[model samples]
Target: MSDQKDILKNLKTSSIDRRLSIAKASFLAGTRWATSNATSFFSSEKDKEKKRKQVLREQARYLVSEIGKLKGSIVKIGQMMALYGEHFLPREVTEELNTLNNQTIALDWDSIYPHLKNELGSKILDLEIDPNPIGTASLAQVHRAKRKSDNLDIVLKIQYPGVANAIDSDMNLFKQMLKLTHLLPQTREFDQWFEEVREMMHREVDYHLEAQTTQRFAHYLKDDSRYVVPTVIDDYCSSQVLCMTFESGISVNSPDVLTLSQERRNLIGEAALEIAVNELFVWGEMQTDPNFGNYLVRLAEKSDEQDQIVLLDFGAIRQFDKDLLSVAHDLILAGYDHDLDKMVLAMRGYSFFEQIPANIKPDMAKVFLIATEPFSSLKNNPDIPEGIMDEEDRYDWKLSHLHNRVMQRASKSMASRYFSIPPKEFMFISRKFIGAYTFMTVIDAKTNLRNMITRLN
Candidate 1:
């Protein structure tokens, strides 16, 4: 097995053609396995189905391994699919793909120093950089460092050499895969979504923008005690290199977090929900990337404050259409009132429906209402009553069976003829919403989310 893996290692070339070649080989191997397994020699129909699933699981695992080896924008796409593709792809595929979120390998320090030297010049020599990165991702790796002048601990985010340059090629390759995989409906809407993603990817590679965005968020969230946005150090930053005050905490989903008392977990979850609400409704500007790695759970050492959630990575900031908030408010109110007609009108106002069929409109309304059901300020729903929630407020992830319902509704929604992409204006914010919701679920957060939003309004 080691020898077979070594063969794969030898072929881990960064060249686009070589990477695709390896992918093609894996696909063919999966095909062969499926063909060989489909035989009359199987004892029963159940055995055949079991064999097919086993083959699928194997192929999915193999595909994940190969994609991790071919890191770049491809890995970024894989991460998105892992997070958002639950509604689009099979459960087995999504389960395997989600692993990519943490599987990216960083370029070694020997291969990375030159880029740092070029970006920071002699200042690089003055700073003490740790040999190993604390975090590695699709576009960059982060190393802990300290200044010679004051010994102030900081983090250096260094972008890979060709990641920015490879955006176009990577998108082209990803588009080709989409056409072949049928992972999404091949329509103008899908194409538009792809283009939006392409533009966002290109924007993300700009460290300058990330630095600026980080600084801006530091200001917006400075007064908020529950959240921490790292302060960017201007003298140490450049187009390809970002330097900021180092924040120490456990990963949001780390095993360490799961050990926290349920009360603490509820606090963290409430903080997270509030952060999402303020970003969407108050600021109207948001850091759209909600990768689990982007948040750190830090304990406060001060006298007054408790724990704080540290926000990291600001490259994907977006300004949403403020009017959409009003529309969303109306939709929720209508849903709470059980006024399907008003809810449909509000959804149409948000351009959620283009040519949606009449038969599905009622179901669609039901879907919308159920989604906002947790937000009901009405005491009728004992689970989430209207009021300032106590520390005991908790939202159960499994109670509503949201995962299965979302999967079903999304499939039906995409099947609609008039269902194009969601309003382009929400292309990215919707991703943020889904990601934040998932995070809340992961933490087993108990917060009246609607009340959180209500307090702000």
Candidate 2:
């Protein structure tokens, strides 16, 4: 009933800053509770493995509860935490973080009309805007819209207000809380990574940056008719607002999108890989967020051409530099060669220099093979078997083979030594391929992965 209560009650994740603050508060509060009740949070420390599991669960729950409160950008930051925060978090916690989504809240027409007038300085009817949002994400919600003058239909992404402010506050508070809680050490390098993440989160709330990335992607995807990149409405865009013509298409993840003919799926898959490779190797400016839902499969009713592959959301583009670029190439080559020495060497080049136990190298090799096993089967995708081969030849079989090999030799204890890739830029690049591989695995796509490796080499 009071002003303070009202302010707290109205705490919505409109800006990066506000959500960040909430996330910090959540973490700080949760850590205090967990620490105070450390004895109770766990069932028994006598059983080391059970204790370990309980500790991990307690930590993950603590972080997730805190982050879930921040509605917009803060929620996005939590998702990013899932991706890049592995070194600082327990594996179980990381797995839990992966489930965190920045559920976006939709705005009604009355609110949207005002935003359009304010951003466009014209009436809502003056411009064509989709009544329903085609898609949504943590920081911003999107709507399909158009410019009447150009007769263009495009996607309009609008940022929630107060997100940036929330982020700035939350980050500073989180940094200090992390030190007090010892959840993440106060290492200089990791501190730098946190700062970078904070910067990225702030940039995400600025729709203007997003608009530029969209245009840049359009240029990158030029000459590819199968791909549809949105055109930026700079005149109608601002830091908190991004307006672009909506590309008519359905999400590649929509259950129906998958039911498309094999050729259609393969065509889109290949196109996605092409864009991903070009962005990673050539452009160096990578749109790292593969919100699988971001891509839309345009129906043939619009054109007889292959279904147009539309890439949406450019708020999380990561740029790669010379050294990072070279090392990434080395990584791919190493995998293609199945050269354990080269792979270890490349892993080192990328910073995986943690002390390895005497017998762990072989275990790591097995793990690597399992992780890369499917791709190792064929150099060229075209040579890949169309249907699932017998159990031994199936993709799942290869993964199982690799995991089994790893389990056979790798440290069974969590404390056992393990090989890891040092932190760097291509982490997301690895995910892009991994995600693509999963999709391809389902669709039975066989591509000459060797084709790309050969070119890189």
**RMSD of candidate 2 to true structure, Å:** 5.9
Against the unseen true structure, what C-alpha lDDT does each candidate score?
0.69, 0.61
- Candidate 1 residue pairs that clash: 393-446, 394-446, 395-445, 395-446
lDDT of 1 by residue, 1-457 (tens): 1233322222123556644755584556546564756563555888876765666566667766766777767777767666655434566777888888876566767778887899998878779999678887877889999998899999999887767777777677655544433334556665766676787788888888888778888888888888888889988898889999998888888787877777778788878877776777777877777878789999756657678899998887777776787776676676455566866777665555546765677667766665655555444344332343344434554355554565466557633433234565554556776776788678766555656645644
The regions of model 1 sitting more than 4 angstroms off are: 1-60, 86-92, 177-186, 254-256, 259-263, 335-341, 357-359, 380-430, 455-457
- Per-residue lDDT of candidate 2, residues 1-457 (tens digit): 1223212232354445554554566566556656655655544555655665666666666666666655555567768777877666667767877877634445454545565567657545657776566555666667776668777776667665556667776666556545544456556667767887898887777676777788888887788787888778777687677877666777566667668776676566666666776777778877766666666778676445567777877888888877777766665666666667766666554444336543555545545544554444443222223442333332433223333444454445332333233354645666666566655654444343434446666
Candidate 1 C-alpha error for residue 35, in Å: 6.3
Count of steric clashes across candidates, in order: 4, 32
TM-score of each: 0.81, 0.76
Cand. 1 Cα-lDDT: 0.69
Superposition TM-score, candidate 1 onto the true structure: 0.81
